[model samples]
Target: MAQVANLFDIIHLNKKLADKHIAAEVHLRDACGRQTLWFELKDVEEDTLSRAQDVAISYFAGKGKPIEFDIAKGINFWIKQF
Candidate 1:
């Protein structure tokens, strides 16, 4: 079974990215000390959220990392594996 080693919330982000959109990076660590990166998009309209989710899901799925996201609140995240 897979296991999560760490969950990193985005406490800081690039100013350019933030100014462009509600986007940030979230990092995850796995049992073997491997790190995976994911993107977070907050306070988005429905259409934008949908597009972002689709792109994120596809990208992260290729990297073999599952995503945990909460749109209502700020981008606080957790890590889990199967």
Candidate 2:
């Protein structure tokens, strides 16, 4: 009965890129209304959406919570648990 957390609300791309790297930012908000920002980089042979997805998977998986993209309406975009 573990609680499921929303990944999208926590991590998002900043739409900025440099060379073969893409920028991703993490935003965390606690019940106390405190927030924090963390910047991350993803290196790829070539910048593409597919590579971005791969980077995201690796990032979250490292956190012990793997997720997959869901395109269905009302469903969380990142919705797999591991």
Candidate 3:
């Protein structure tokens, strides 16, 4: 499927419109069996909300979710968590 984004839509999205955009994105990802695992987002470095990801990392880390990144084995079959 084609991912479409345009400047006008991005610049004009209010709270309601932004929520619709997020819901649509979630529906599309769910339809394709894609999930947003926390491991994949713990390295976010965006300018505005980078600290938000840090907060999640600290929270999950306190709960002991793979609190390390020492993966050495290559994925022979499929991609698993680090």
Candidate 4:
């Protein structure tokens, strides 16, 4: 798992997840006076998405807030300034 240093890497990961039938959403934001990024998975089974989420979480964990994911729904991610 390489560090996501730019938008391209983010987009690439999203496509990869989608290719695997996983719905992933990536959001970028600068809010709350802090800079942070997060990834969420929705509209998927917990079992199917868990592995992906684990990898993602491991990559971005502790960067800010804990990553939030809902496999039963869809996948979404966001960045915030807090």
Candidate 5:
């Protein structure tokens, strides 16, 4: 909700400052095998979030679903709606 929106705002304003904020919230969105990695925050010229990020975060959070993304399992994600 506002949490992710505020993050986008900070990122748009200052990427350097956003790094600190993301680090702080790492614990909330992730554990050892974190999956809520929202957007690509590296080496990109564009300073905007992708459509995938916006829709997925909103849909998953709204439906109380968790997306489990695993690189080892053939690099895919599943929205656990069960």
Candidate 6:
């Protein structure tokens, strides 16, 4: 059940980030604290991406799940979450 919840959480976060035009790279960690999966974002804005990360964390945390997201530097982010 927990694994499924985590999986859905990852999926939901990914979709939300994508919709906001923020390129992201998702790395799912295993129960043993090892990375198990990786997702890379396509065309996106730097500012939107950064803000998206913050919003995502908050959105997920509100759902009783907190996620860690890192945005690479030198990227151009223009869009805001609103």
Cα shift from native, residue 24, model 2 (Å): 7.3
- Candidate 3 ranges beyond 4 A from true positions: 1-34, 37-46, 66-82
Question: Which regions in candidate 4 have their CA more than 4 angstroms from the true location?
Answer: 1-4, 30-35, 54-82
Model 5 spans > 4 angstroms off: 1-50, 72-75, 80-82
Task: Write down the RMSD of candidate 1 (Cα, Å).
Answer: 7.1
Task: Name the Cα RMSD for model 5.
Answer: 12.6
**In order, what lDDT does every prediction score?**
0.45, 0.42, 0.27, 0.52, 0.38, 0.51
State the lDDT of candidate 4 residue by residue for 33-81, as single tens digits: 4433445657656575565665556545554434555445434443322
**Top-TM-score candidate index:** 6
What's model 1's lDDT at 7?
A: 28
lDDT of 5 by residue, 1-82 (tens): 2122233532342433253342211112433433334343443334333333344445456646555554662123444434
Question: In candidate 1, which residue pairs clash?
Answer: none
How many angstroms is residue 69 displaced in model 4 relative to the true structure, after the best TM-score fit? 11
Which residue pairs of candidate 3 clash?
A: none
RMSD of each: 7.1, 8.4, 13.2, 6.7, 12.6, 8.2
Query: TM-score of model 1 relative to the true fold?
Result: 0.37
Candidate 3 local lDDT, residue 20: 34
Residue 65 of model 4 has an lDDT of 32
Q: Find the candidate with the highest lDDT and give its number.
A: 4
TM-score of the candidate numbered 4? Answer: 0.44
- Model 2, 8-80: lDDT tens digits are 5353333322322554333333343322223332343344445555655665666665665545421123425
Candidate 2 matches the true fold with a TM-score of 0.40
Prediction-by-prediction clash tally: 0, 0, 0, 14, 0, 4
Model 1 lowest lDDT segment of ten: 5-14
Ranked candidates, highest lDDT first: 4, 6, 1, 2, 5, 3
Per-residue lDDT tens digits for candidate 1, residues 1-82, read: 5533232222332333454463544444333444344445554565544554444455445556666665564233333465
Deviation from truth (RMSD, Å), model 3 = 13.2
Q: Kindly state the number of residue pairs that clash in model 4.
A: 14
